[model samples]
Target: MNLNNIHNVYFIGIGGIGMSALARYFYVNKKHVVGYDKTQTNITNGLIDLGIEVHFEDSIKNIDSKFLNSNNTLVVYTPAVPNTHSELNFFLSKGFYVLKRSQVLGLITENTFCLAVAGTHGKTTTTSILGHLMNECNVPVTAFLGGISENYNSNLILNGTDVSVVEADEFDRSFLTLSPDLACITSMDADHLDIYGDASELEKSFKDFSKKIKPNGKLFVKNGLPLTGITYGIEDDSDYSIHNIKIENGTYIFDVKTPKTVLENLQFNLPGRHNLSNALIALAMAVQYGCPHRQLAKALASYKGVKRRFTYHIKTQNLVFIDDYAHHPEEINAVYQAVREMYPNKKVLAIFQPHLYSRTKDFADDFAISLAQFDELLLLDIYPARELPIDGVTSEWLLNKVNNKNKRLVSKDELLLEIHKTSANVILTIGAGDIGEEVKHIKKELSIAS
Candidate 1:
């Protein structure tokens, strides 16, 4: 199966962040790109605006005739698409050269020198930072990222062909499909219990991914992670470490101690120690790939961050509003920690929409403790992305365990009303699901109120 032979590329889940990046890759490469998604999103619209066709319905009839030829057409679907999806079933029945999104990503990067970033959290931010680092240094590279990079305004960053940077997604053990020349596992927390069922299996899967690295290729792991690799941390004993960390005007002024030398007074704009660690790993990867330390530091300092990962919708001395894609308990804790550090003692209002029922149920206690850190909480119903409701798993149930007097469950319609009711100074909207779609509305109302 040579990718060169494929003339038409049809994606069953083209609107997904990862899928849309691939769709754009195919379109930019002059393939006849078309696909179907269950909804029309900014991603799908961007593809359509570039002349790629997309349909929202799941019906088989919506598939264009140009993609019917088995000899020249390639069909790709995400794992999130159910087995019962009509368009996917049609493609499978017709014996199209169908592939999972990860499989196709693997095939595309198989020949390229790939740097894959894998983690339960921080994958997007790390990948984006790596992509920006390589690009800024004028390396010939392309990156397929999981989130839209604020610098590029797109998930697919195309520089040249010598290198590839991608998020090594662990949702369905998808990162294992990639054959990476260099890789990093920033975390190995328990997630996607619907797939792995337990944390031990999840850690084993991370180990499996490390073994897939090409011979003589390097692997980087965050300090204290079970996997052995070039280690990185802030103010810790690792192969790569950062120290003298201080926030000056909301930016980090730190010194990094690498095996080679110590670079001082480096600047980083993103908040959170997690992101500081993320930047360190990306810097380590770029330097390992032979990027100049000076150039890498400059790039990391300028990276605007991924759109939904600590994205600043409004930043003023009077009020600050940040939107983040923090679905899991660890992620939520990071957000609150960053918020508290940045604006200590301020009234921090966090409106969290639980991503999936299974996750909310599995991590209820952890989530409760994390949310309780905020001064006020507005919990929304669980956003069931690819799952049905789990009995006894609801926002009210999670809210009851929060152990905070200022927490309440609310609906989307009442979100604005509830937010308006609060006189909080710092506002945070955290989650991974459709909560992102509401960012615009929330930003607008906050701006108008200001």
Candidate 2:
């Protein structure tokens, strides 16, 4: 269906990171945007500030009558929303043109020069960086990111519409919705097992995503992943590689060698080798799309990173505090590596909240091993994003598997007191859930304690 024909947009689960970006997009483009969220959040508040009505209640009566018309109304919903959601069921009952957020994203990109970033991890940072580069280069672009960019302070970056940048989410096999003109799979690590049920199945889904790229379009994959594509890695023999790496004053100074040229002294402060690989894929794709090499490097230096993705709230000579959205074992390992690299010899404390109970149960051993890498580990109860808690899949259950002697379960209320007890100098909060809401409190307490 042509988006131009839709006059009103209604969203279910409007508070979600990806959903809110679409809500903002249609709102800015002059559509009457309104929706329902399970709760009020900073994101929903921002949308309300933009004059889009959002209600926390799940009643059908909350939807504006303007969006009740099936002919002109476009109903969008996230998979995270329960199938029994009242507003959603009501729309379905009335025979409205309801669509999955992913389907709508595909429709939006169907005619545009779309560049999609897909992965179990790194998609947010990579997509955000790519969008920033294209925007700085004055390319006509609109990026729908998975996380709020620190530079733009928003997840939706609307520079123009000729180019569309999107996070091709793997959950629910959502990436398959896009027909990307150029795409990259940063890592196809098994994820959302609750959806895919097995690692091989997840990999097959990624391969299917690769097939969705336009016939003439380019595909980039991180080195060692199973799929075929232009590969990228650090100090490796990939099509695009990073070399001459150094860290100065907490920033990365490196050079990138693409198929066409070597761009030297490219500075980035995103704080991980994994992130450098992410930036490299973004750089290679942008260069392939005709962005000048110098412009890409210049934009890389100014990239402030996405919020909650290795975001530092307090950094000083005496102590350091960082927060990240590293919910998976591989992602947690990368965070640990980066933190250790950044602050060698300093005691690093990690506080992690497992995002889903099913994921926790599936990767409990792996999670235990990764969490053990920190100087100290504090595990919180699993944050059940969508799934019901599996029997025996709890923080204490995972904490027992941790080989670290300095590990303990933590409660949100007593968390401040517990942190003060630990003598760790570098404190990191890692998760993909409501643990973010506690960051401000943690930061304030740390500032006073330090």
Candidate 3:
């Protein structure tokens, strides 16, 4: 569908990170943007600040009448929105033009030189890094990110529209809709089991996405993934690799060995080997796209990082508090590695709120193992995003499997109290749920205490 023909763009779940990016895109493009979300959030507040109409209610009357026109209005809904949502149902029964958020993303980027990042993990960080690199290098690019970039303080990087950067999400096999000119797969871990039912199917979906790359386009894969593409890794003989890594004053000083030459003394600020690997792939992609290595290195160094991807709310000599959007087991392990690597001597306290019941149940043992690595743990009830409670799957059940003696189940109301009792020097709020909402309060309390 041609976006130019659409006069009004309406979003059913406009507050979502991905959806809000699209809303911002259309709004800047001079479309009359209106949306409905079940809850009001910081994202919604930002949209409202931009003069985009947003409401929390689900009723039909909440929608503006101009969006009711079937011919000129376009409806976009997120997959997370239930089939029973009133606004979505109204649009469907009224025969309005409707599409999933992914479909709209595909349509908008199809004509541009699209660069898609796909994986169960690292999609947001890698995409944000790539977007920053291309934008700083003066590429006429528009990037729709899965998280708010700290550099731009926005999800949609609106430099120009000749090149488009986006996260090729794997949930619901959404990435299949886009035909990318340049693509990368950071990982193919077993995730979204509730949707794919098994790991093999998820891998199959990534393979299908690789085929969606346009003719004469290139695909980049993490060195060990079971795919044929230019490989990137850290300290290895991959097609593109980062070697001679050193951390000085919390900044990584490494050299990238591309297929052609070695670019040395490149500096990156984000912590963790996973982030180093992420920076590597982004660098590889930009290098292949003909961006000068000198400019790419400067842009990579300037990238602040995506919000909630190891965001530090408080960093002092006595106390350190970090927050991350790490829900899956692999993601949790990565967080653990980063924390341990950074603060090897400090006692770390991890407060976690499990995201979905299906995900919690599917990876309970792995989750338990990952969380047990912390010095102390405060487990909150699982946040049921799009799924109902599973009978045997509960935070208490998962907490019991954790081998750590300092672990205990806690409520959100008592979260601060439990955290205050811990003598740990490092405090971590880890999860993909409403745990993020507690970051500011926790930081304030910790700052006063310190």
Candidate 4:
């Protein structure tokens, strides 16, 4: 599909992080952009601020007349949208140039020198870091991030189009559509079991994605992953490794050992070893792409990080509040480790909102074990983003499995009250669903109490 020929671009689920990024990309490219989302959100508000029309309702009448012309309009829909979505069905019935968000991403990056980051975890952070590095080094690049970058305060980094940076998402095997010139896999954990049905199939998908790399192109893998390529890890013997790691004033000061030479005194402010590893792979990919190590180091240090990856809403010596998008068990463990490593002495109270019914049922034991690490826990009901509720899979069931004695299930209405009763100094609101919407209120209430 020639994007130049399409004058109008419409998004069916415009509030999603990935979809909004694409919307921004088209808007910047001078296309007439409009979209429909089920609800108004900060993302939709930001899009509206850019003069791109956005409506919340799914009615056909909500769509502007200009976008009804199939010849000049291209329709993009996310898989998360229901099959019964009226706008999506209308576009399909009209036989407009309809494409999945991933398909459109693949088409956009096909001609460019693409750098894609693929993994169950760390895709957003790794892609954001790489995008920042390439953009800082003055590479003519356009980056479509899966999350909003704090440095740019936007998901689409619009520098130039010669090189494209994107998160090669693996949901529904979406990354298969992207053929990247340079690619990296940060992890291959057993996730999205509802999609792949088992762990082995998920691993197979990553292997398939590795093959999608262009001929003679490079692939970077986390050192222990079951893939043959340049490997990166922290404080270990790998193709690209970080050593001399230490924290000073909450920022990491480490030296990266690449195949060529050691890049010393590199600074990254993001907490957690996972984020440090993310920075390492981004650095390794940038080094292989011929970006000067000196410039890359500066960019890595300058990166503020992707929003909700490990965002600190309130940080003080007396009280600390952090919000993160860690729905999977492995992600939860990473968050736990980071919190413990940073605040070893403080008592942490974790409030978690499980994301999906299938995921909760599939990894209930693992989630319980991960959540048990906290001193206290407040469990919320499943968000049920795409799936219907599964019988016998509930927050109370998961809470019972947790070994921690100080755990209880709470509703959103009771969340603030439960939080007030906790004696823990460190407060964490964790999940990937509408739990994020509570961050502002949580921060405000906690700030006043502190």
Candidate 5:
């Protein structure tokens, strides 16, 4: 596809994080960008502010006339959209050039030195840090991230395009479409069971993605993951490791040992050992991409973090509220660990909205174990994003499994009232669905009480 000659870009689901980044990119490039999302969000509002026309309906009439022309307009759709979606079907039936977001990214980044971060978790933070490090080192780079970076306030980071950074998403086998000069697998946790059917199949897909790294390129893997790559971990011997960790005034100070040299006294403003691993992998990749070690170390200290990934909504001496997108049980465990480490003496309350039906069914016991770590638990109804309700997999079922004595399923409205009545100091709202929409309101209410 001749990207330069293209004047119009249309997205079937423009409200999505990844899709919004692409829309922002095209809009900034002066293309007429328009799209259809089933609902509007902060992302959609941001796009509207950027002069990109976005509508909330799925009908063909919502599509712009200029975007209807098959030759000049490139249609991009997220796989999450239903197959019978009217807007997507219209583009297909009209013989328009339709591409998944991954295909479009693959085509756009083909000529650049692509640094693709692929994994079940940590992709967003890792990619964002790599983008920041590259830019800090004065490397001309453009990064299409999975979430909004607090530093840039946008998912897409644009610089002179000598190198491109992207989240190599594993859903729908999207990362397989990209040939990356450098790649990293931050984790291989079982997720998207509806797509892969089992954990082993998901591991197979990640293995395939690892092989897509360029011939002379380096592959960074988290320690103990079943992949042959330059390894990274905390307090473990790997190609890259963060050692001598200490928390001074709520900030993590550590040192990193790389294949060639040890970069000492690296500071990460983010909490969690997982975050330190994420930082190390990002640092390793950026250094391999020719970023200077000192600059990368400095950038690590200043990189704020990705939104909804350990986001601090309320941080005072007595109260701490964290919002995270941790839907899976393993991710929930990580979030629990992070919160516990940050506020060891404070009582922690966790409010979780389980994401998909199949995922909850597959990991019900694990979720129970992880959620049990919290002192108080508020469970919401499952946010069935694409799946219909499965029998025996309701949020109530998962709530019953939680070993915590103080756990109950509550609606968002009841949650607000319930939280207002609670006395817990450390509160966490965890999920991967519309639960995030409640974070702002919850934070506001928590702030007033605190």
Candidate 6:
């Protein structure tokens, strides 16, 4: 278990966001890093460009020979990989030291001052904000984020080695492995039912994560999230809250009132009240970590935000396009609020691709209500990332429950053509699936037509 003894690091699912971050970290540290993924992506290509060996096939032969030795090679894998993967089995049967992505994160941050952000939503944005705050304050911090940060243009932010920031994911109970010096739970909504089976079980898992904070550490929670922690919210009686909020030129400008300080005129370019809350939580954590109030305030104002989380693809007087990863019903509602608040007079069109079949079946009614907020809607067939189809849970069934008359179901192939025919002033592509793979094409088409 002594990491210093290992010379080669190999990943089973290296193209995944978190796993790629880890691979990049080892590569930067001058270790031999190689990985196997089922497919290639922009992320994997970036890693390859950095001289990290990456192969698409799952065969054991693709693994570098240096990593074949059990004593010197360390294996890491994502939970999404199947048990029967060829390369994974080779390492396992040969007695390589294997670790889950979460376990490796836990091991790396154990000796540092860790700031962990846990929630069903908002974890990536909040963690990215916290990392920016620390970096701006000249703190020696490293952050492993779930999404590519627009500010840093990378998921791994390496400032120094003394402190660390991480998104404490709740899926597969991964957050349980982290013991944070300071932790926050942004929201505890029911999600990932395929893993927990019910909302109460999900809440119980979060409570356990809250208890994992160090004895001397602090815990921040949304004001009324049914948890006992130092509270945070917007314009409410919490330890920290955003007050005097205003929007200028489509940006959020606000003041944060912490327990002992009222930081003034903190500006953020990201949209939605939910994002404002995310910024406030990050600000509070920075202050608690001894970052100067003025430093944290400046960092908040300068943050560009995480990509695909309310990302603006086009913004002209004649047209506006946004892409967001809002898979859950509550997340979609937040996206709806941000779009309507920003352009109340415009005719908004929402194009959503449901992520998972089980999730679509579990929250069909809520999804219908949230998607109905748009002036027009286009529902694509469920992306079905990890699940097979469920009977009677098609996009057509969900479309019928929507209140909007302008709604229609379309396949990914017909999406651009249908979009070309619509008279949309504001365009929003909302989903957590591979629909994001279509954002650039949609943006290019709309940009040229307009």
Candidate 3 C-alpha error for residue 108, in Å:
0.4
Model 1 per-residue lDDT tens digits across residues 115-188: 99999989999999999999999999999999999999999899987899999988888988998999999988
In order of listing, the candidates' clash counts read 0, 0, 0, 0, 0, 0
What does candidate 2's lDDT look like per residue over 190-255, in tens digits? Answer: 888889999999999999999999999999999999888999999999999999999999899998
Of candidates 6 and 1, the better by lDDT: 1
Model 1: runs farther than 4 Å from truth? none
Query: Which TM-score value belongs to model 1?
Result: 0.99
Among these predictions, the greatest lDDT belongs to: 3
Each candidate: RMSD to true structure? 0.9, 0.8, 0.7, 0.9, 1.1, 1.0
Q: For model 1, what is the C-alpha lDDT against the true structure?
A: 0.92
Q: Report the lDDT tens digits of candidate 3 across residue range 59-104.
A: 9888777977899999999999999999999989999999999999
Residue 125 of model 5, lDDT score: 88
**So what's the TM-score on candidate 5?**
0.98
Candidate 2: misplaced stretches above 4 Å?
A: none
Better of 2 and 6 by lDDT: 2
Per-model CA lDDT versus the true structure: 0.92, 0.92, 0.94, 0.93, 0.89, 0.91
Which wins on lDDT, candidate 2 or candidate 4?
A: 4
Clashing pairs in 6: none
Question: In model 4, where do residues sit more than 4 Å from their true spots?
Answer: none
Worst 10 residues of 1 by lDDT: 59-68
TM-score of 4: 0.99
Give candidate 5 misplaced runs (Cα > 4 Å).
Answer: none
Q: What is the lDDT of residue 65 in candidate 5?
A: 71
